[model samples]
Target: MIFEMTTQVRVSNFDEGRKWYETLLNKKPDFIPHEGFVEFELIPGCWLQIAEGKPTEGNGPLRLGVSNIESERERLIKELKIDKFEINSRPEVPVKWGTFKDPWGNHLGFFEYLDKDEEKKSIKNNLERTFN
Candidate 1:
């Protein structure tokens, strides 16, 4: 059975890619496997890999969950100089989302659940299952 997972995004320049990912993630990478590769542990077992290479088209829109979509979007815009991407949702949708790309064209995005209580429950459950 699958227990852990990783998703990769590529960039043509190593130093620029590393710095861009650091700004986006708001932390230094958890691991640097070699000169041109790095890994961030997004959750307990989920990893995001950034590598030096030609970026592939249609590689992602690797969406991450956030606490507040609007605030996060604003923060990204001001801090990362990201374009003001539209936040989207539907009447029945439980979460709102927005997507943007890095300088190298690796698609990335963020989402926020409308129900904070449910989001907390999901986090607690996932942590328990992953750790216990």
Candidate 2:
């Protein structure tokens, strides 16, 4: 059974990619296995790798969960200088989400649950898994 996972995105320039990712993540990479490659442990077992190479076209909108989508979107727009994107939701959907891209065109986004209790439960479950 699969217990852990990693997703990779490529960039044309290594240094610029590294700095952009660091700003987006708001932390230094958890691991830099070699030159031109770095990884961030987004959750306990989920990894996001950024590498130096040609970026894949139309690859992904690797969405991440957040506590507040609006604030997070604002932060990204202001800090990363990404084009403003709209957050969307439906009555049948439990979360609201928005998507944006990095300088190298790697798709990324944030989402937030409408139910605060569910959000708390998810956070608690993740914390338990992390500490256990």
State each candidate's clash count: 0, 0
Count steric clashes of candidate 1.
Answer: 0
Error of 1 at 56 (Å): 0.7
- Candidate 1 stretches with Cα past 4 Å from truth are none
lDDT of 2 by residue, 1-132 (tens): 677899999999999899988988889999998999999999899999999999999988999999988888888888888889999999999999998889888888988999999999999998897787
**Could you give the C-alpha RMSD of every candidate to the true structure, in order shown?**
0.9, 1.0
Spell out the clash pairs found in candidate 1. Answer: none
What is the Cα-based lDDT of residue 84 in candidate 2? 91
Model 2 C-alpha RMSD to native: 1.0
Q: Which ranges of candidate 2 are over 4 A from the true structure?
A: none
After TM-score superposition, what is the CA distance of residue 96 in candidate 1 from its true location, in Å? 0.5
TM-score of 2: 0.95
Model 1 error, position 102 (Å)? 0.7
Q: What is the Cα-based lDDT of residue 101 in candidate 2?
A: 89
